[model samples]
Target: MRRELICVVQHRLHDKRMGDEVMNIPRLGVGLQFNPSLMDWFPFLDQSLDALEILFDGMMAPLDGPGLMLPTMVQTMDEVVARFPLVGHSNYGGDFGFDELASTPAVRRHVPLARAFGVPWVSNHCFYSDDSWCDVWSSPLQFTQAEVDRLAVRARALQDAYGVPLAHENAAYYRTCPGSDMPEEDFLARLVEQAGTWLHLDLHNLYANAQNHGAAGYSITRFLDTIPLDRIACIHMAGGRWLDNQYHDLHDTPVVEPVWDLLDDVLSRAHPGAVILEYETESLHHHDGVLDIPRSIDAILADLERARSAWDKAYGPGNRQTTRAEAA
Candidate 1:
């Protein structure tokens, strides 16, 4: 039963009849997170960028507001997609790790907005955001078979409803849950396989987890090896700061040297469709109604270009061909 379901989901996602309307992200191109606050900076951004990953949470209003009706924001987003291709990434209105019933209301409403902007693929973080409700981001999910199954179902439902490929991102956990029955990588592998969904592998998230909790032999390479590389459609790289003696995926700084090295390792093995330089400028807001992004933006784009140059050197230009097993 599970095998049949997996094959069916995969077939629907890869249906070629969907054609160019569906995004085929470049294999070695730089992407940035979409921020309406940075409209002034867009003119200065490198023209070589391949795509934009929009966090629909900020782009659109909550589902309770008349079903996907953010007229002004939708107009802004439409202008963005008109100029560049877009990929969707969200926390699913703060309940991403839960069951479909808890998540689908928001995901369903978000799809029309996404389709309006011509977003072809979307991604959700693998974590819960309900309990604390204090932080800007979500807490790590509890790792167990039940949680895995719940996320798998939600992943499939999201892709089915959107009629576009949806990928689940790995969590950047500071600590492992006591009740975890399996390794985080193993749980993610099972979840992706069960849902037959793609992966939005966040390299910096994996790096942060390794730095914080890998003292007990939790190497990032081992974690990478456990995930099916062929299932990866997008790769994310970000920078963060050390808080309370633990490294967090804060997206506040520039890409560190360690993450740059790991990007090389990832490219040597898997062929992801697009690589994104994920940055968050929400906290940098000033009284002038402008963001403090000049320095950081330049740095982030340079690093992304560096990654692009390195990928071309190693894998050659546009080496996206993959075998059935690798892509499956």
Candidate 2:
């Protein structure tokens, strides 16, 4: 009963025995989307932890060879395993919501990290943006199940090659919202039913859709009810901005009020097995001032904590744990 499946090219399959050990990601984890001023190609860097978004480029031959790849950037999953109290970069998702770099092999090839990073999930945004990706699609907001399926096919192929599942987040499209073959909810649900991979539920995107259109462009509750919950692997929460009467998904500041409400609704229904704060690294520190990162990170962390608390109330503490030892 599958519809569209996408995957990457097959390689020497990684041994499960070689799999990274499972670790519990705290409700609040740091985002690696920021580009640090300092970086060099080396191994076992003790200082690069400051750089955000764990730089992963083509240079790293043996992932665990003599040296670390982008030492000043990526904190090896093994190194960060027990060193840092915060969850590792496994929670990182390329917020290329509107930036499509399909033709760029390195950008498109990031999914293989499921093994390299020991992450339970690898994900990307379903919404297309930026002119750089127009070559792959007719338009950014080309909203149609057919269009989404085309995109999903590419993602499925990556999953196949890596022997790991991939999840696509429902994107908030204000610039190019297209009328779908069916309602957005049904369209998204059918996509998951057709693809065996999984879904990265973004309550923030859903909230944006409702706000831009009437509350019915997609029903927060109905969207939840329709999607095959079993296909969902994680939940994503983030904030945005509004200016000149337009709502933009900045993923920078704290989540808005409506999105927070939608998240509570999500916690009530199917509690996400794992939740992460999708934030922009640009918010890390403004060279011109005393950055307000403490507040921003705290907001994101608080929302994630709230999600966990609500989850405990609904599913009970016994059902919850950070490690994926049992699932894998």
Candidate 3:
């Protein structure tokens, strides 16, 4: 029966007032995209969105009690999505990222897991940056357009087979491939059009990608232009962890400026779905060296607030009048 509910995702974008409903701004709400202990920290988050990283599968498999045993997450997400925020799937596996789980036995049985978890949709990183697996090339962008088409065909098949509404988030690439055929936006737009799905649209990643290449490469503004506003299912907001000279997308930090600019651009163009910052770098049950958890969370929450203000300026009170004035 729950699996039947998963079908709603297919029909959601078609609903008459989806645009208006999506644009309705809400007050402050904290959404968590990583870790369960966050529940203990932010009690009020019960009303916010909670997305689960597929790497969290390890916890879901081995059930037990409340402390931390990787309880059956599919069922858990169903229950949580019912109450506070629902659970959606992030990338499967560790920080490196992997998408093969759609074919794995455990994930296969959990297609209804999204519905069961009360999750309306599921999201994964769009680009191929799986550090754990050597089979796929190091850089997804490096591949030719034909190569991507070949891969998208298979990827979309997995999306359909999984039965959950699926979308891909762009990832931060350190450098551009010398011989890459298509631009990142082209690849992303094609993937969405072909799959008949939407995107998670990680604005921060777009900034990073643009900075690495050049203006000619992947500018955030150009990236936004490439994606049709109607097809953007949901959006993700995250802070990039500045390590060494490169930026790592760790959600623990407050959002930086460039990403904020991109978010403004996106909100001006598309609507927001569950916007949970990827803040999952806390201690795992006090076992992994618990540090200032609240402080870290506050940083992300503050960033979320800033983004809300930016959205307001673009589409909220002031923008509405501006549009009216221009039209009149």
TM-score-sorted candidate list, best first:
1, 3, 2
Model 3 clashing residue pairs (backbone): 46-84, 59-70, 77-117, 78-116, 78-117, 78-118, 81-86
TM-score of 3: 0.67
- For every model shown, the clashing-pair count is 0, 12, 7
Choose 1 or 2, whichever is better by lDDT. 1
Candidate 2: tens digits of C-alpha lDDT, residues 1-328: 0111011101212333322232112232222232232122211133222112332332232423444244432433334433322211222222223334343332333444434444444555664443333332212334577755665555555555434455666777664455655666676676655555567777778777677755445567677788877666566667776657766666756656676676666666654445555665435322233235555445545655665565556656544443222334
Candidate 2 ranges beyond 4 A from true positions: 1-71, 75-78, 83-108, 129-141, 177-179, 281-291, 297-301, 322-328
- Please give the CA lDDT of all the candidate structures: 0.67, 0.48, 0.52
Q: Could you tell me the lDDT of residue 53 within candidate 1?
A: 78
In TM-score terms, which candidate is top?
Answer: 1
Instruction: Give per-residue CA lDDT, model 1, range 1-328, as digits (tens).
Output: 1344334334434543343355344453556777556565644234545677777767665555654645666455545544555677777444354434444534545676555544567777876753223542546767799888877776676676666677878878776766887888888899878987778899999888888887867778788889998878888888777778988887766777799888888888887877788766633322323335565566666776787776676677654222212345
Residue 184 C-alpha lDDT in model 3 = 78
TM-scores of all candidate predictions against the true structure: 0.80, 0.64, 0.67
Prediction 3 global C-alpha lDDT: 0.52
lDDT of 3 at 295: 60
Q: Which residue pairs collide in model 1, if any?
A: none
